[model samples]
Target: MDLTSNRQSWAVVGGGILGMTLALRLREQGKEVTLIEAARDIGGLASAWKIGNSVWDRYYHVTLMSDLHVRNILNDLELEDDMRWVETKTGFYTKGRLLSMSNSIEFLRFPPLNLVEKVRLGATIFYASKLKDWKKLESIGVCEWLTKLSGRSVFEKIWKPLLRAKLGENYQHASAAFIWSIIARMYAARRSGLKKEMFGYLPGGYRRFLQAFEKRLVDAGVTIQKGTCVQHVKRTGSVVKMDTADGFEREFDHIVFTTPAPAVSKACPGLQPREHGLLNGIRYQGIICPSLLLKKPLAGYYVTNITDDVPFTAVIDMTALIKPEEVNGNYLVYLPKYVDATDEAAFSRSDDDLKAEFWPALKRIHPHLTDDDLITFQVARARNVLALSTLNYSESLPPVHTSIPGVHVVNSAMICNGTLNVNETIQLAENAAVDFLKLDSRVAADVAGSRCAQAV
Candidate 1:
């Protein structure tokens, strides 16, 4: 606990919540911490942008009642008082009709599934929610597991479309644990209170929260370097050397990489072939989300699941959950398409091109919506938003401590048992920081012992 005697300096790469959280914790433990971010601002995927005249999240994000990790961070920052919770409604766009599916009554009357199939579907959700052992579910494919439990009709009508929407072509290879975690989280939220699907959001989006977080980090004696990309990372015995894009290099006692696994391989090429292979072997699904500022609501539902053939995966009316007054009384809608990262066509499309292509589908979902109602449109793309949770995913994760001494790798890909989200990311950072500090302590002790032996 006497960290002052050790006096080790640490470099936390990547400015996402994970990196920021780890940096803060490490600093609190008396470590000299430096946070390097590639972008001008922090927050990574959780980062925000100016929408029309107001600032909002680039992609859709919500805090659930079960997100204790997120709540803890908010409490620490004293931003918990700014949280606004709302009971949201869900819609389903199937057979070319937009229908509400928020409550039991709507679900029972849903036309896609018969009464028997609906009952089977409910049973499947209940069973998944009660599941305590997720390891066994990892070996089973989602498609196979859902079909077996919910029956083929329910699987095809309900599970398949949702899986496709979130994972694109990788859904078939996903493990049953993928769906299990989602079901469990949603179930926990309902059980927490009024049995309603309520989500929380900060009044000024995450901008104010992130600004406050940056101030806290700076105030805690942490060095924050923004708009700096780390070009290379090389570990030399007890010291880790990092070279930046601007041809600047510095030495640190420890380094924590919070970027994607592939980025780690690129930064530190000295890693063993097996280590590099493990990092590179992981696949990710990218997202092209377009946030539209509209004058009116789209479907009057927070999230509208798209089951029919549509360009985008889902339509999220952020204004439905977030009050219109928050965004200058303008409705905010997000159309997100989850595609394979290798899909060049999807990634190459310009914002204007996407808007034109997706506008027709938006019209189909909301017939009342018109061009006159549109205020502005912005497109945001993330290459590695969610890791493809395939079979044996947990076994494939690389250790936090890599083969390179004084260097560590921690990112979203390591989240195998659960879905990729802010809460899970924060939890991973907290756990990784503990492991990193423990390893650093052992290494420091070993170095001191070696020096004493040499003196003798």
Candidate 2:
């Protein structure tokens, strides 16, 4: 499949992991690639910010042992030795107490559920993990399925609150496939010999990986245009043209939009009205996460699930998995709240407002945590962090190939059976690149045949 003689120019309109990976792959296949990023920096949702002279991820992220896609990327970058794996602990904040539920013994001893209810819950998890066809679960609501399998008592006390924390008010409308994917991922992490839940992180975090990847892209002759916002995309004859915010226009043989659905709709107005409506109708959930640098550790648990109603959804002690020495010997904790991305009020709230609202809730869990223990606090907002996995969500996803022949759409919203993570994003990018190249090869063959027929 050497495309050297039939090289096609491509424009990847997004700088996230998906866009970056796709552009790199296309370049490797002898295609002229130009990656356009609206943001000044790369990494998108996985972007990082400076913290007291050290850099860390803007949001909490970790690599599960089962994330083979991520591992492959690391290996390609020659960073396998940089990975550090650690067994992490999980905690449940309910009944006005923090309970450890990392292992089977602890789960059975949990106070919220009786023995029978706990048994049913365990069986539900095991059953869901073993399921191979997630499409079957798409028609069933998550709440209804969980209740039927784990009973109402366990559903309300455990599953409901956790679902609300992640999906907000849309949890009830979510499909059973949402929970099935989650259980499958967690189950795989514990299947090893030790059966411990282990997570891996690079010593310097994802920032290190992105830096290496960007360097490779440049060395491989991929054009990276940063801080360039694409306004609209149109197909003119056999080429795709992009209009940027700076009044500059560029043309390419093919265009791949790796942005969210809303951005995709905005950039490609030439799409049919029906196609536009479907893309616009897709909804997303946002996050307002505040990272706190503390002089002392607040909780030893890697993640504390809040079953109780609180200002924030979960308390994640990133240092529980990452050594404090990595970040200048300071503990890092993240308090995240998932909200509707369309809510103007939630997106407009100030960092001080979020701190004031979440401070008391933080104190409840760490009674000893005081203002003196906090070194600094920063807030990060991702307006379209996760796509809402509503029931039959797969049916609503726009096709990868749009009405415009050369234009394609691939984003987190297309992830029907799995959660949005780095690994899934990479997998989607790889698959989309393969599909695009195959289609391009067919088009080239057709053009060649037409020219020969006319000559004859």
Candidate 3:
């Protein structure tokens, strides 16, 4: 009973955060794995850049105190020293002014909402804070649910703008459950004692975490084939056939598709227009990173949230969030804009174009900050591949195990609620590995070369 490349082979598609974490675990268990990445680097969505003897994350990624899965992985890699937690700033920019709201005093007396509205908002959020399970709330709309419970004014001012920022034009149709999940995480999880609380970061930025993962993965003997894409996946009786980018045909015993649903449809086109209809329904948004090499701190807060005042959704100052000293007189910022599938205008625009558009919004957010404070700046937009998780899009997400026997698909698109942190990615990956390894599937042992006999 021997399994060679001809007999037992496992392939992991996409070398993003999710794929890399899963690949490391699979290789440790003595499984021969091929982690294929189209990108030259391993960090996918959260990749890093080098600048003047230092590296910074493509987009800011922070580890929550509640991020246990990421913590475990860090410990496993023995990279505890590389990580350092710092208390970052969080503020709201509303109606032509910047509000430094780091405490309850600011909360009870915020300018946007009147006193009665503030009291109601407090009570409603406090109530929403309690409800962890959204099963019953899923059927209802967020607008209706919040208005009925929290009052219409609160929804119009706070929730409406917040939803508009995240989901774009699709906010009204969004599930109350989805909205509540975000609120619950903000309220329930405490980084410090404060609710709607604190966030964490690694000392050398997220590049440290990515490097740690890469080192461990290489050490674990996982074959990382970078700059390669899997073109097609076909099944011929027992063996799974793959057509790669370089016109090479690889036959595998098991295969996992960690690419986005859109990519999945392209790779396995035969399953689509029918059986795997969910793949066609999935949507996604594009994110932009605007890192400013500045002479001084842009704002006192790391997270500068926005409801109104400009076209940009939210502005993030990374230097304020991570160890500011490491940033060395430079400020890094990230701006997220939601775009539809056919609308490639935002995605197609050059980084210079993005900086042009986004630069005005920054001025609007903080008018007092002069041109002299800004030294040099660059905007880095990723070649995005993750899917948009709308309302019950989770229900529509393609599971790890496909209807077609051995094809497994797992990506951020599958994740419905909760934060899309590295920790969540690891959990999703391991669960997906179990499904592909057939550990989650109950099969009577008639292993005909990794193909379980379907009951006749």
Q: Which candidate is the best by TM-score?
A: 2
Candidate 1: global Cα-lDDT? 0.89
Q: Sum up the clashes in candidate 1.
A: 0
The true-versus-predicted C-alpha distance at residue 51 of model 2, in Å, is 2.5
Task: Please tell me which predicted candidate would have the highest lDDT against the true structure.
Answer: 2
Q: Give the clashing residue pairs of candidate 3, or none.
A: 283-388
Per-residue lDDT tens digits for candidate 3, residues 1-456, read 122322246788998888897787666555788888888888887788865445687676777767778778878877765666666657898777788777677787689989988888888777877886676676677788888876888888887887778667767767777667667666644543544455777777667777888888887677888888889988878868889888867877677877777788888866745546787677665555566665666776877778884666777777766665777656666676655544667668786787677777787777766678765566666434445545555566666666656677888776666545676688888776665556423432345425634533
- Models 1 onward score TM values of 0.97, 0.98, 0.90
Please, what are the lDDT tens digits per residue for candidate 1 over residues 1-456?
554754689999999999999999888788999999999999999999998987899888899878999999999999998899898888999999989988887888998888899999999998999999999999999999999999988888888899999998799899999999888888877744335697899888888788989999999889999999998999776799999997778999888899988899999999999999998888889999999999988767988988898999999999988989878999999999999977898999999999998887899889998899989888999887788888978998888888898888889888877778889999998988788768777877898999999999
Q: Count clashing pairs, candidate 2.
A: 0
| lDDT of predicted model 2 | 0.89
For residue 342, give model 3's deviation from the true position in Å.
3.5
